[model samples]
Target: MFDVPLMKKNGSLFAGIALLLGAFAGNARAEEMSLQQAVEIALQNNAELQAFRDEKGLREAGRIRAGLLPNPSLEVSLESGALTGNSGENAFSVGVSQEFLLAGKREKRVALAQKELEVYRWQLTDRERLLRLDAKSRFYQVLLAVRKLKLTEGAIELNRHLYQVAKERLAAGDIPELELNLVQVELARSEGARSAALEGLLASRAELSLLLGGKEVEPALPTGSLEAGGAVKQAQAELLRLAQERRPDLMALRAEAEKGSAELSLAKAEGIPNLTAGLGLKRDTTAVEVAGLEGKDTSYTVGLTLSMPIPLFDKNQPGLRESSARRDSAGNRLAAAASRVEREVAAAYASLSNAEQVLSLYFRNIMPQMEENLKLTREAYQLGEVPVLTVFEEQKKYLEVNQGYLDALYQRQLALFKLEAAAAVELTGGVQ
Candidate 1:
């Protein structure tokens, strides 16, 4: 006896342990990720976003530096006796001087820095939004590629079976050799398609990984469907208004304009020359013989000095003109940005509408009809009532129509993302 009952018990325990380990591995590989997680990862790890953060830090440093006062200067000097005279004397003096701003130049400079910091803040936000769009687009592309690969693989399997059936019919003299050759050609084409789909899927995954700021990422399926959703209900006018109010780039441009104005004010204030004041102390000592007795004398002296430039030249006129030009430029740029936003929003809306219409045509009319035709043609071909070529053509037509529908779905989602980008707000999920 081999301890049959004890052997079964140990086998059962080992099987259960293996299954548990497999389940854990499966869970680890799947790593269910949502669109929000993808965007968050990009924001956290993206190199460009990191650079923007550093730039923001620099702007903050500028603000701190602008609010500080000018440093005082120390002056020291030593002098000795005249060249020819025997009256040897030595004296030393030390002074401290500070330049005081005449107007509110310090305040103006600080205000300018503040405005620049605000601009950088908005720019960072804009950059994050753009990266989110990129990540979402790449994520959806991976999903599309995976779906395409599945579709091609299925087609390849079906075609292979059909080719085998055709070969059997030819050997039995029930189908012509021409039909078998055509089926073989279709099988070859399907295999090629499968290869292309596999390549595309790999490329798409790589792109998504790059966007996620990873050197490489595990091959995981996107957790979503490409189902179409409700149409955009907001009026175009309302969308344009929202874009104007919310777009981060527009806000940044406005901030830049304010900064320019502040800079101009600073330039004007700087034209008022600063006053420099100095204070010093000196000690003098003397030795003399008075009535045959040696006597010593010491004295201390205090001196004050004040000075200012006459502003006759370099009165900051050029700086004023430059700042004025920049302000005007910023105004023009703001107007252009508004127009660009309007155009982008209108274009995206139109594209979304067109994609939705095309999708409706395919799903409501074309797809059902194509599927029915393929089913009927395949049945007829098996009954020897129709040729194999007819069935093959129907299959091809079905594949083409479905592929077109997939493209339309992707376009709709992409248009929605573009609209969000233009409006500088969250619109909808990339895929349904």
Candidate 2:
């Protein structure tokens, strides 16, 4: 006859071994990556950075075109009296004219183009700064997701163990059926939370892969703990100063305002009139009554012509007005950018301070106490001094405490990132 209980135990052992082996295989397949390595990959492969670089190249081409002089024009004319039997009275003329810009117009145009190119370079710098910030944010988000998933798994496993204990106690008539049913319900809830956490982890990884530019990336695990990051080291006043000096967006706007000033100067210079000079050659085959010359004789003449516009009615007044208005607009925008940077630096600094305080509270008091309480509750249940429900409650509390600590850690890191981005400088050494 079959030993039914022994067979069931052996089946459970085999199932546990299978799950362990699967976990080991999965771990073996994952690659380990640090946050710095992730940012480096994003910098190399990000599509938006490539687009910005291409735009800079386009601006360079435009700058070169702006430096070139205008093209010279050619003119030609022919006249004949063949129908009136005066074929000898034929004349042909050809001329070449070149318009020369006055009032240093060419130099002004080239200078404006140079300023525009500088603006583009500054724009590229700002784009890189923003993209780097986004990449770092995504990297930390993945780390948080991984931590949450692990926490959920731990909670689920603990619940499963407690549920098994409850079943054993009920079978031995040490606990009521209601107690076992409650543990069963808690186990189901833990399992559902784990499922939701897994979905979240998957979504976070997908977003990270997109930021990395393509689908060819390897599956990698974040190597560090959430507790590794530190708070910002600089004061808000110092950070605001750094923002004014180093922030790429602010610099780009400054360049824009300078370019606008250059444009206004160029517009004013356009009011000056240009000089047009022409050289001409004429040939006529004719006989004059005062000259005893044959009709076959050829007469040649050369001419020089100089022309200038009166500039009496319109002298680029509209262009000057438009450029002046744009220059004013640019100045206003730059002032606004400076104000916004100040506000952001102050806000980020405050958030970092609060996060540091919360994290300190968790590390010093809450987490340790929850862990100790869980251990004591488990011991009391074993000694028959406490019910299974007490152990379950303590374990749930411990999980929540750990979750809160992770949240605080993430918040601190996020605030640090925002502060660094706003200040346009590095304030700490590691993890950031």
The lowest-lDDT stretch of 10 consecutive residues in candidate 1 is 1-10
Candidate 2 segments whose C-alpha is farther than 4 A from its true place: 1-28, 83-85, 287-294, 384-390, 429-432
Model 2, span 1-432: residue lDDT tens: 111111233333323323432354453345656777887888888888887787877788878887888788899999887888887688899999999988898989888889889888888777777777888788788767767766776787777777777787788888899988988898899889977876776677668778877665545544455666654567789889888998888888999999999999999889988999999999988745546655466789999999999999989999999999999999999999999999999998899899999988987878767777877787677666898777877887787788788788889888888888888886764212
Q: Number of the top candidate by lDDT?
A: 2
RMSD of 1: 8.6
| Each prediction's TM-score versus the true structure | 0.88, 0.88
Please identify model 1 stretches exceeding 4 Å from their true place. 1-30, 82-87, 216-220, 285-297, 428-432
Worst 10 residues of 2 by lDDT: 1-10
Per candidate, the number of residue pairs that clash is 0, 0
